[model samples]
Target: MDMIVWAGAVLSLAGVAGLVWCILYVMRLRRKALDDATMRSRMQKAVLVNFAALAVSTLGLMMVVIGIFLS
Candidate 1:
């Protein structure tokens, strides 16, 4: 159970890091002043990563809860 909790913490951290990366990526992209079509294309990719990060974070939280309950 303790291991599970620790693993969950790590996963949560990774997800947070990914989210930060996405934010930075978008900010940089905005500064590039690309065309609308290109910007939209890049943004679509970022949105997918953002959603994946959110899902990973949610899974980590669930794991933590389950670990705690089991312990």
Candidate 2:
């Protein structure tokens, strides 16, 4: 249970980092003034990263909850 909690913490931190990255990336993109197609392409990739990061964060939260319950 302790191990599970620690692992969940690590995963949550990783997801937070990813979310920060997505924020920065979008800010940078906004500053770029790119064409519509180009911006859309980049945004598509960011959307995928955002979804995966969200999933990881959610799973990490679930793991923490489960660990607490089991302990």
Candidate 3:
């Protein structure tokens, strides 16, 4: 049970880190003067990664909640 809690915490933290990274990446993109095609490609990749990170974070949070309740 403790191990499960720890894993959940780690995963949630990782997701938060990823979310922060995505925010920073977007800021950098905004500051840069890239061409439309380049910007679109970069943004598309970032969006996909961001969505995955968000899903991970949500799952981790749910797992944590379940673990707590079960324990």
Each candidate structure's count of clashing pairs: 0, 0, 0
lDDT at residue 60 of model 3 (Cα atoms): 84
Residue pairs with clashing backbones, model 1: none
Assess candidate 2 and give its lDDT. Answer: 0.90
Q: Tens digits of per-residue lDDT for model 2 on 36-67?
A: 99999999999999999998998888888888
User: Between prediction 2 and prediction 3, which has the larger TM-score?
Assistant: 2
Model 3 poorest 10 in a row by lDDT = 1-10
lDDT of 3 by residue, 7-58 (tens): 8888898898889999999999989999999999999988988998898888
Question: How much is 36 displaced in model 2, in angstroms?
Answer: 0.1
How does residue 27 of candidate 1 score in lDDT? 97
Which segments of candidate 2 are over 4 A away from where they belong?
Answer: none
Candidate 1 local Cα displacement, residue 30, angstroms: 0.7
Q: Tens-digit lDDT track for model 1 on 1-71?
A: 99999888888888898899999999999899799999999999999999999888888888888899999
Q: Counting only residues 3 or more apart in sequence or on different chains, how many pairs clash (N, Cα, C under 3 Å) in candidate 1? A: 0
